[model samples]
Target: MPQCAIITCNNTHRRTKGGNVRYHRFPGDHNTRTRWLQVCGKTVPNCSTARVCSRHFSKECYERDVQHELLGLPSRCRLKKGAVPDTNLPLDFLKEEVLPGSAIDILLAVGLVPSQPVQKVSGGLPRE
Candidate 1:
């Protein structure tokens, strides 16, 4: 199942109290994608596979009549074009910004940075 990208949301393609939910793919448009990231408090490096569940959006975002037509089908919940999440979201979703020269410090504090710099491999793509 495609999991909802929101860290705190447990919505998937399952039926919930609200009804059958949908998982919308992250926008191909960068600006819209950024807005989605901000709403969910995510810093996803690449969102090609990211999806936001229907629960995160308000009623205005969906075409209820169209979606209602397909209520019993495996596929339900049709959204409007260029739709973006605008409800039930965190206003402050992102962690503190990583300041210049402090990323390593923060990573180290969280034990993510290596003890030493990793050696660069010389066998990948050719340099330009």
Candidate 2:
């Protein structure tokens, strides 16, 4: 199972916990991936494998068609194109990547993550 890329989130695809959660992968484009990195407040070596769970996004980020649900039908959710994680997201979720000789390199060299997370949001496991 893949863990959420958000520093404080522990959400997984497990059946228990809440109910159902969704995980969105990092954008493939360099510019968009950089935007996501800035929003996420984290520096990752590989962007392709990073994922952000749905709990971080606002209702507006999702597609309108997936917003409505029929009685007894399972909910369908998908983010809008070019959507950026914004709602319930932390600006200080983690340290950022910066130029060489900055804390970014030091932290990366030392392999140090943020000492303690300020907060953690709980959500259901992902359906997929």
Candidate 3:
């Protein structure tokens, strides 16, 4: 049985009488893999042997066709590009940690910066 890669998730792709659960491998592309790692707050070595289960993805991540729905075909098993695991995470996962001198801190170091108000012109666009 393959277990989910997410540290907070415990869904295992085990065989069952009704059907077997599905797991997806981490993307091979550097950018995509980086995004996955960043979202999971995990490193490469930790995720090298890990796989995320389909339950982690949103319904949009899987493909569904009208015909398939009519015929009662199984939902598509493959994950779409840019699909991020969004389920079975710990509550703490929703809380982002702000480290000292982090980007947000740097941006707020000088206190709140005021935004320039948009000026409307006759052309229906803001003047530069």
Off by over 4 Å in 3: 15-20, 44-48, 96-128
TM-score of 2: 0.57
Candidate 3: C-alpha RMSD after superposition: 15.0
Mind sharing the TM-score for model 3? Answer: 0.56
In order of appearance, the predictions have TM-scores of 0.54, 0.57, 0.56
Output the lDDT of residue 8, model 1.
74
lDDT of 2 by residue, 1-128 (tens): 55576666677767424666788888767787777887765677677777888888889888765334645466577777788887666656433654479776688788886565345446644333
List residue ranges in candidate 2 displaced over 4 A: 15-18, 66-73, 93-128
Candidate 1: what lDDT? 0.71
Clashes of each: 1, 1, 0
Residues 1-128, model 1: lDDT tens digits: 56688867877665454566678888878787777787777566668887888888888887666455567644446677777877666645543564456777778777796565456559854444
In TM-score terms, which candidate is top?
2
lDDT of 2: 0.71
Task: Give candidate 1 misplaced runs (Cα > 4 Å).
Answer: 13-19, 64-76, 91-128
| Overall lDDT per candidate, in order of appearance | 0.71, 0.71, 0.70
